[model samples]
Target: MKVTIERTALAKALGHVQSVVERRNTIPILSNVLLQADGGALILTATDLDIEISEEAPADVAGKGATTVSALTLFEIVKRLPDGAQVRLELSSEEGRLQVSSGRSQFALAVLPEDDFPSLSTDDLETRFSMPTSDLRRLLGKARFAMSQEETRYYLNGVYLHAHTDDDAPALRAAATDGHRLARIDAPLPDGASAMPGVIVPRKAIAELGRLLEDAEENVEIAVSSAKIRFGFGAGYLTSKLIDGSFPDYERVIPKGNANVLRVETKDFAQAVDRVSTVSADRTRSVKLALESDRLRLAVNNPEAGSALEELSVDYGGDPLEIGFNARYLLDVAQQIDGETGTFKLADPSSPTVILDEEDERALYVLMPLRV
Candidate 1:
């Protein structure tokens, strides 16, 4: 295959496709990206058996052909070329390699047969929804951090997406938990989605999708099936295998009916916890929060080291209560709070407490208490 594509344009497309390509592969062809030149455009495809990404860019084509070249090698060559330069890629059948040329630099990459490359099947999708890139990015960022890495409970390794029927209407719900803390966000459902199936989107897919959606405000089309899910942006298409295991019924873990409420400034609470937890050892980073009347004090005790106590004023009318929580979990939830002040609903010192966004009733967070 012979094609001439701009350096900047080719680099952008390669950056997207190469991320899906595995660094090491037992099969030789899996390390290369399949390049097809036809109809004034160049199509690049890369996959790792479970997930696949395809991107297209405008290019000048002299001959209609297809070939496969190492994705990493090709990307490195494009990235090093002169800015705004045109890159020419040609197939050398006699030498059994592909030649890449841009201005003064050149490389002959090993070529593989296009027939050996595997392609993802395009099955019919049941539910389709269109969402802005900004909204999708926000939803993923709010919940993805809480996803678990443990493999014993395979379902908790991804974010659970479904529609909630709380009242007379349906709302879109996205949640992630690792048994320590949970994050859940609710958004207004789109017009086409009245009913949606619960699906567990794997961690890798969520990470890749976030990278693709960065700095893009255009609309993205999403479709789902029993086995797979697909995302189609204007420039590329992404498909991945859904987790086969069923996610647990997460509603029961979310605490409710906690009357003891305390509203404190998010920035203030986060700073206090960060300061108090410094003396604690690495393995034990627990901080105790003592609430009394209108004053909130954060204290951390370490037998080998020292103890720290800091105070912050909060608005609370309930009785004085003391609770201990992991310093790391408190900072993560506080960082995600969009509003200035956050309300923490507590029933007792041992039970899991609920946290709500004072400005937004839709977003909810539950952090499990710890024994200090």
Candidate 2:
């Protein structure tokens, strides 16, 4: 294969595809990227058996052909080249090497047969829909923070996406939880998506999708099935295998009858928590919240370290309540609140607390309290 492409365009496409290639692979071809030169563009594809990413970049094709080369190696070479440089790639079948040249620099990388590269098949993707990239980005971004990292509950290691009804209106919901905290965000359901089956998008795929969406076009096409999911941007697409497990019924954990309500300035509450938690234990990182009439006290006491206390005026008229929560978890949930006022619905110190943003009714968060 002989093709010439701009350094900037080649590097961008390589950067997108190489992210899915594992650094170490038992199968030799899995570590390489498949380069297909045809038509007026070069298609670069990389996969790790479970996930595949492919991108097309405009190129000058002198001889149309295909080959495989180390993804990281090629990416590094293209990235280091000076801006506006033209990159030329030629495959020598006799020597089994791919020659890469730019200006006065040249390198020969060992090549693998493109036929050996694995692909995640999307032949069974029965549910296909298109949604605004911004809407999809918000749904995944807001809830992905709560996805579980522990492997014991493998099913919880992804965001659960499904069609649902919010106040009798059809909506698409994304939810994730790690047992201690939960995040649920909803968006208007696109047409023809009501019959889509619920699916758990693995954490790694969620992260990759998030990065890709940053440079994606205004709309993104999505296709889903029982076992896999695909996201198609205007220039390229990503296909990933779905987690083969059932996510828990998360709605049960959300409390609906919490009577205690506390409305505090989001920034003030977050800052006060950050200040008091400075002396908290590293393991627990617990911060205590003592609430009364209209005042809230934040405190952290560690015998080895020191004690810290801060007070903030809040809008609360419920009975006085004291609750302890992980400082880091509190900050994470608070960061998701886009409004100036963050409302907390609490029943007791032992029960879960519901956190909401005053301006966004479509987003909800639940935090499990810790014993102080």
Candidate 3:
């Protein structure tokens, strides 16, 4: 394979795909990127058997061929090369190496047979849908903080994306929970998304895809099957294996009959909990919250460290209630609230409390109270 490409464009395309490739691999070919320069563009493909990333960039094709070269080494080489310098890539079958030349710098990287690289199949997807990159990003940001790190409950380790049709209209919902706190965000279902199947995206896939979504705000194409999911936009495609286990019936966990509702400035409540929690010891930082009329007080008491008491005015109509919640949990939920007011609905101090962005009804959060 031989091609000449602008150094920055090559680096950007290769850099995105190389992130999915691990530094060390049991199969050597998995660390290399498959380059195809036959057509009008240079196609770079990399995978680790579970996730496959492919990106295409415009290039000057000197010859029509394909080969595999170390993805990391190529990325590092392009990164160190002078900006705006053009790069030339040529593969030599006899030498079993790929030559990378840019301006005054030149390097020879070892190559592997492209056939040795594992190919992740996409035949398992059952449904496909499309949404703007901005909407996908909003859903991910709202829910990712609640994803569980514990592997035993593998379903909770990724975001749960499924169809949601409420009284207003059908919608797509993204939800994540770690048993203690849960984040559920719903957006208007795009045309033709009603038939999409529910799936739990794995943690690694979400992490990598989130990085791409940071810069993609126009449109994102999504396809899902039984075992794999693919996201496409522009000239980049990310294919990842979905978690096979069944996600818990999350709807049943959400509380319905909470009568007491209190509204406060989201930032103010977040800051208060953050400041008071600092006085707590490393292990336990439970904050007791007392709500009465329109006044809310947050306090943390520990024998070793003194206690902290902070108060904030809020909107409340029901009788006074005291609840004990993990300070960190409160802070996380508060941060997720998009509006200025933090609306917290409660059944009592012990029952699960629900928080919402009062200005928007589409997103709701449930936080299980922690015993103080």
Name the 10 consecutive residues with the lowest summed lDDT in model 2. Answer: 163-172
Which runs in model 2 stand beyond 4 Å of their true positions?
none
* TM-score, one value per model: 0.95, 0.98, 0.95
Best by lDDT: 2
Off by over 4 Å in 1: none
- Model 1, C-alpha of 161: deviation from truth (Å): 1.2
The residue-level lDDT of candidate 1 at 214 comes to 79
Per-residue alpha-carbon lDDT of candidate 1 for residues 1-372, written as tens digits (9 for 90 to 100): 789999999999999989988898999898999999999999999999888988899999998899999999999888888889999999988999899998878888889999999987866678888877766776778888889999998888888887787786567778999998998987777666555578888899898888888735488788877778888888788898888888777779877788889999999899999999998778858999899888999999898889999999899988889999999889989988899999999988999999888887778899999887
**Alpha-carbon lDDT of model 2:** 0.94
Question: Every model's Cα RMSD, please?
Answer: 1.6, 1.0, 1.6
Q: 70-124, model 2: which lDDT tens digit per residue?
A: 9999999899999999999999888899999999999999998888777888999
Which regions of candidate 3 deviate over 4 angstroms? Answer: 124-126
